[model samples]
Target: MHELSLMGDVLALVKRDAEARGFAEITRVRLLVGDLSNALPDALEMAFDMYKAEGTAMLASEAQLALELRQARATCVLCGLDYVPERSAAAAMCPVCRFPGGRITEGEEFKVLSYEGR
Candidate 1:
């Protein structure tokens, strides 16, 4: 999965920052993942485990990856309704007005929130 590459980039960035800060090992990483971000949480965790198994110098043996899941939300222009959107649907639909022109208000986030190292 693309999560491998994504995790690789994340680790590389974290390692660089940690080294610059004189941190010997990274203990934890926290990520904010949105439902519409297209990155699977399970795959990201597996990728993190794979990298940790490689015994990377900057990563602690017990390094942990924590994910904060953000739910996808949409607001209907026609009906003024706010609801969770269907991820697989091409367009967000409003249940009240049956409009397929709802605007997405949240979700679509994929970023590293924080990292702990010492």
Candidate 2:
């Protein structure tokens, strides 16, 4: 699965960071995921659980992976207006002018917010 591959890459970076900083045990990892990033939160969690303690020698068995969804911003194609809709998922059309198929300005990022280690 794509989420599995993505989680592998994330854990690799975390392990590298932990090694460079000489952390004894990784406790938690927080990620910011965008709505347009095409990442399923549940699948990502399951994937992370599989590898959180694999490559990282110092990772705790109970290490937590947390993901938060970032709000999406859309710009109207016709009106050239940018706005954040009340509900992003149901906002395929522009809320203000009823424009169809707005281009996504944001909410396409998948970034590691922070990690806690001892």
Candidate 3:
């Protein structure tokens, strides 16, 4: 459902790039997906099949997904302590010096690392 829409968006972006760069045929697509990014690789592949139907790019294209694991970061505003968050804990707090809320600094990103075509 959502993956289909998401795949549509990705295909649109890729089509724009292909047209702008004069890529006649897309051979492969390489994507680096962050752990926090709400995308399932399997679902994306399935969605790609549905979205890219009857397209030039679809005839020779396939999406290659690379999952990126991100470490949770917690930055203490009170003491400026930067530390990795524990997976078991719901929220990460400063271990050395207790802080009310340690600001989360990373783990939210989705991007296309590379696309090979033409």
Candidate 4:
């Protein structure tokens, strides 16, 4: 769905980096996805495949894209306790004391891990 557009952005970023780095071919692209990021794993991969078929004229048609998800975690603002909250309250306040606002310690990540090119 929207992952298609997200993937396009990712590919475009890689293409720009490759050009700036002077790499003629990009062999691999790695992405760091968070569980709470709301980005689906399967859909992201499918988007990459679609982009490859379109031959963006930047990345090699055979360029590989890897998506890796990180576990979701949060830290309690009041107790300073760290735990994984349920999907329902990931962004809400701490379940225990409901004190300070829940801050995401992990997950909710979308980044390029690494890229291999020549």
List model 3 lDDT by residue over 1-118, tens digit each: 5877776776678778987898876666666554445666678777766554656344363534344555557788889999876656666678888665778787555566667677
Off by over 4 Å in 3: 49-63, 67-69, 86-92, 95-100
lDDT winner among the candidates?
A: 1
Give the per-residue lDDT of model 4 (tens digit) for 44-108: 98888887777773667778878888998888877887877677752646767876566788998
- 58, model 4: CA deviation in Å? 2.6
TM-score of each: 0.93, 0.79, 0.67, 0.85
lDDT of each: 0.92, 0.82, 0.65, 0.82
Sort by lDDT, best first.
1, 4, 2, 3
Tens-place lDDT per residue, model 2, 1-118, is 7999898888778878998998877889899999778898999988887776464435688889889898888898999889775553565588778987888888889999999898
Model 4 weakest lDDT span, ten residues long: 86-95
Clashing pairs in 3: none
lDDT score for candidate 3 against the true structure = 0.65
**Arranged by TM-score, best first:** 1, 4, 2, 3
